[model samples]
Target: AQPQEGEIIGGKEVVPHSRPYMAYLKIKVKDRSGSKPSSCGGFLIRPDAVLSAAHCVLKVTVILGAHNINVQEWSQQRIHVTDWVIHPNYSSASLQNDIALLKLRSRARINENVTFISIPRSNEHVRVGTRCRVAGWGDTSVYGSTTDVMMEVDLKVQNETLCQQEFHDYQRLSMICVGDQNSGKSTYEGDSGGPLVCNKKAHGIVSYGPSGRLLPLVFTRVSYFVPWIRQQLRRFALQELPASPSSQ
Candidate 1:
């Protein structure tokens, strides 16, 4: 959906998290008069890697340290994108397995402000009502536009049973739901593929919308995709090393 003006529409307040580990992804698209460069939210997984929605990375120059409202002001870091691996089962229309991993040309320097978040282990269940954090550089106002600086919000977990009931057939085991229908604040567009962290660990990746016209948000559970993540990490690790002496 397109961005609109106004901070809180229908009583919802869009803001950033206090201590966010997320980064704004400024995608440099084809230069067109009247067409702004596309932007999305993402987070560091390892010093040399980034995690974002597959759809966000499709044909774009990713710039780290981007903000939500000031595209021109934010500093563009090193241009480094060796490869992008989208989940094999990703479906654009359905937003299923909509995650992607980005390998950088060089490792990102981790400081107090920039660091990787821990991924939830396989089968790790985050119970309903648990507080989880969602961060992004997406729009603060509904239909407004994406921002240059990152923002975050706190949301409560929704159980699988309720998620199934709400999403029905569209919901997959890899997805999880969060937020309160009554709460006016929740994640929005451009937040897809960002992390849903709890207890300082990434439990899910922002995937779909609020389900109904007025509901919460849905995410692809990280636990269900732990094996895939490990496999990717292993592949990346192998590629990083030099040939063994015996092989040489």
Candidate 2:
């Protein structure tokens, strides 16, 4: 069966301010030669840090705290990415380790609308049939345009073995497959880098999907990268630490 190519297949509109940690990332090309204004979804991990798929870390500007793509509200926060770090092992070919951390130029104000989301522990496991929620501002259906407002859908975790049957190269250890084989509800192109939240914790990062097939969507397992995330944070903190007087 031909998979639908829409961003968010069969999703409902997310209520404004409901998912505050959800981030709408805008990619502004330098010369405007490529795609005019490409966009992706992500989630706030810290006041100045955002977690998203490595593919979303293009050389462009990123905007956070956005609700409606068409309207700018006080709750919205825009930050030019000072820098970003993609997983060292990230593969553009196979999309392995498709995770990245975006550093903001300045700390984002934490208010009613913008906050960070908790990540699952390294040992946490999301079993098959577990219901999770994913929200993004991507195409509502195949061959449809991206939506102005954010949308969300509920999806269930699928068994890794079953997912492997579908994708020949699926890495079960570091990736998660989500969707209902029967319902065909799945994420699409513009929804890349969005978080898959289960039990109020981010368990996966939307990675890729079968291009024209709505079978199941793939995500980078957040639990597998939890240690890496802590390492990055600790490394950054050390780099920012002041030099000791004795050393000076």
Candidate 3:
């Protein structure tokens, strides 16, 4: 049987706002008039910047914070997206360098329900079999309907050799593989651009996996892109910083 297009396999519900940095990316259809909104997951790395998958950026309307898709709550804050930055070398065909940044029109206020997550240091890499957490509001089963509440699952970093076999295009230096061979916990549809956190640091960005079964999930290795991420942040900071008054 063909695996369902999107959803988590063998995962549990997560407490609302527990993962404060998580951002819900909604793609609005301009002409569909009354069509259901399509969504993807993202994470906040800065007050005004959201890290997400490049593929999810097209026609994205807004970033919802303290979000739980199924309900309207006082904790929810919506920020319009002002712009976006995609990696220069991102490849749609190979899904390499599959990361992007969404610039918020206004900065998000930090509070208990809205915060940022730290990215792994440039030289850091979690050892194989290291446990990590991935959270999102995606489907609960293959081809199953998506959930309104968020979900989280534990996965272990897999061996490069094993991952390479499963994902023929897997590039160890640029990608990290994670999955639970025993529990079958993996991210499916609607999870792209979400964080793979280890030791309270984001080590990967949910990239892709087999469409049907929960075998090995590939992510954009955060450590490998630290330099690029820093460059973007620095550029934005410089642009937004007030210029010093020139001496008369």
Best by TM-score: 2
Per-candidate TM vs. native?
Answer: 0.81, 0.91, 0.90
Distance from true location, Cα of 4 in model 2, Å: 9.5
- Residue 7 in candidate 1, Cα distance off native in Å: 5.8
Pairs of residues at least 3 apart in sequence or in different chains that clash in candidate 2 = 3-212, 3-213, 3-214, 6-142
Tens digits of per-residue lDDT for model 2, 104-160: 778888988889999998968899999999999887777665678888889999989
Per-residue lDDT value at 144 in model 2: 66
How big is the RMSD of model 1?
4.5
Give the lDDT of residue 139 in candidate 3: 73
Per-residue alpha-carbon lDDT of candidate 3 for residues 1-248, written as tens digits (9 for 90 to 100): 34333335567777767899999888865554665667888999988889998877777755555456767678777888877889999989889899998888889889998899999889689999899999987777765667877888888998998789887789999999888775656787888889999999999999888755677889999999888988887767666674843221
Candidate 1 stretches with Cα past 4 Å from truth are: 1-20, 28-36, 65-76, 210-214, 242-248
Q: Residue 104 deviation, candidate 2, in Å? A: 1.0
Clash count (model 3, backbone only): 3
Q: Is candidate 1 or candidate 2 better by TM-score?
A: 2
Per-residue lDDT tens digits for candidate 1, residues 182-246, read 66666776666678889888888877665334355778888888888777766776677745322
lDDT of each: 0.67, 0.82, 0.81
The order by descending TM-score is 2, 3, 1
lDDT value for model 3: 0.81
